[model samples]
Target: MIVVVGITVGILDVCELGSHFILMSITIACGMLSEAYARGPPAPNASTHHSERQIPFAACDIAQLLIALCWGITGDIAEIVSRARIAQLWAATGVAVAYMSIARWLGNVIIFDRKKSRFVANAVYGLAFVPYATSWCALIARFALAINGAEASVPDWIIAIVIGMFFGFTGTFPIIHALSINRVIDVDAAEVAYAIAGVANKSLLGWYMWYGVNRMQTA
Candidate 1:
């Protein structure tokens, strides 16, 4: 399944190795996050709670950063034009990914009762995606401008709005956690859903952004 998805995505004009490798990494990361949460922290307590969350979150973040670093270092911009500009874009994305990752773990630690509170938990966690979404929107704009040598596409704004909403949706994992905490959803089901969302956000959306950029760059 991973290979199939990777090959499909790699069909786009880009660095095939980097694209395939990153897609595979994201798939594995999604599974790791789901499994880790499903197992429910090695020891759940106030003192160790933050640590448990940080480990898996950090692993996923590292995987994302690795791909960004690979593209930046290797000049692997999908279209191969303006290597310097694309490198800057990847650098910015790396920073945003790091910010988003930090916000995830820290938000959970700072916002107590994240799994218990109905509204506050979901709201707080959802805000963490702000950086991630914003970066991508900007990336799209700048990338389009670079490729077209003109104003960014008007449709880019629509894509930006959709990306924002999508990230907002992704951050609602606290709801899933709450469901598991209250036993409203069985642990297995919650984990499976969580894994699906993780894959969608990290792997699917990431590919969408890259593919979009590739199309613009090549067109």
Candidate 2:
């Protein structure tokens, strides 16, 4: 709950990690106050580790920061084009993967509800990857522009949606499946569904999606 709420706060603003911590403290303090005032029975299960494990709080935080930092690269693509830039974008993504791995490790080691970790972490991480992908798209667009010149003409919003949906599908859906929806209990059903409609569907669909994104440049 706290982690999800914190992530939600972060999503609302780029500077939310700090704000989330502060907000959490205030909320905890208020909850304590309310508990103290109650003259009747005890409060709810406040003793349990949130998600049933010791969340790699620092690790998860670092992951979010790492992700945000990777996103910061979009700001530098132009410099990259004319200067020294390598196709090391995967490195940026790796940092995020490590963090997510840490979170999962925390979940398993601590006996946290695996399901919870699956959903929240997936949603957060998957959605998070979009900016990084966008950075690449922008870099690509810049290169295309440089070659073709004259604006090369394109619609950014379309690119935004394609990029957004790509990450959303690639990252989010599987996580939602493995974690939140607990698809393992119904493997056959999941396969049928994913085969026909899920992201597991194929690269052509992905390419189609990417093509739509390219149209953004002309839009």
Candidate 3:
């Protein structure tokens, strides 16, 4: 339902940068939900070791990765059709996909491996935010150019970069609660944390972009 509503909102204003970000974010939220459900049915026999029951979880992770790639491509399509090529949008999308794939692999390693390194796991996860931040920065820069013409100056770029970092931090930081794997912490708690981060990254970020665009247009 959230995905449907988000996509609908974007469709209503397909040309808007805010709409594109909103759509991409919402799809990401859905992908997060897919990741949360990676665990499958219990083994039918008690003799079946947990290590042997890897197929279902692996499949679900793949599904989540595919979901991310699809939505990333959707945003790329929007940029290609509706907006100027200010950011080399496809390259950003490709980078995002690549980073996310690596992050997913690291996540699995952290989850299943006995020698999991939390620092490496966290680093990859944090790095995944870069593409989104760059895209947001590009959108803001494009907006400034639209409003200020050739007069869009250094301060404008600085402000956009700052705003992009703010969004990136707010979106990615909370997911650390999930990424920092601990045997003592409840798995459900981690899922809840992830869901919260999804809301911050997707819905709240989208709202801020929409509000900023409206303010800029009116000013």
Candidate 4:
């Protein structure tokens, strides 16, 4: 739950810029380390252990699992942040539903699994920012809320643009695993690109989150 840890750390005194960057670098390093390990020669499958041990990563893999766990924790932290914006939640949900509807139609009408690559599925999953969009979706909802005596904040266009890119890159996370996409990773150095993108997205979201919080507080 590195995410949970990160988010927890974020809430714990708002994380000064330097400390936050340091922790974020650690997070990226975790991803890189995990990638390096996965790229190492694949070990033979051991069937002796129960629980359908397809690939032994239990005790053998410490860093990867720890990172995963920490990320989960960060999600918990984000949820805490989100709970403060119920109006944004509703607004983001609406946005997601509407956006997905149109996306589904487009997917069906065109680009409907032309190649049908598993990697593509994973990449699409990486792009899908279901809840994270709330950071901006809430902003949109705030504007809408003002329509009829509803208290809301001004829609900051700058933050929306920034967060949109962040959310877009956040989606590419899964496919970034160099080990997972061997061919593309080898040819395109996509893993490195993904690593860079991941950090960028996180930083962008961080700014968006902090900006929103700061503005709302002062508003």
- What candidate 2 gets wrong by more than 4 Å, as runs, is 1-54, 59-111, 114-150, 155-219
Give the whole-model CA lDDT for all candidates, comma-separated. 0.40, 0.34, 0.40, 0.35
Q: What overall lDDT, based on C-alpha atoms, would model 2 receive against the true structure? A: 0.34
Tens digits of per-residue lDDT for model 4 on 77-112? 333235344322332222222222222222321222
Per-residue CA lDDT of candidate 2, range 1-219, in tens?
333432343343233234423543443443333323432222366455443433323344344434433432332232233322322232222223322323333333224333354345443544444455455444444453454342322453243234334433453333323522663323322222222122111222233323322332222
Give the better candidate number (1 or 3) by TM-score.
3
Q: Which stretches of candidate 3 lie over 4 Å from their true place?
A: 1-39, 44-70, 73-120, 123-125, 128-150, 172-219
User: Which regions of candidate 1 are displaced past 4 Å?
Assistant: 1-26, 29-124, 128-143, 150-219
Residue pairs with clashing backbones, model 2: 52-112, 153-217, 154-217, 154-218, 155-216
TM agreement with the true structure for every prediction: 0.29, 0.29, 0.35, 0.29
Candidate 4: which stretches are off by over 4 Å? 1-13, 17-22, 34-40, 44-117, 125-136, 139-219
Q: What lDDT is reached at residue 39 by model 2?
A: 25
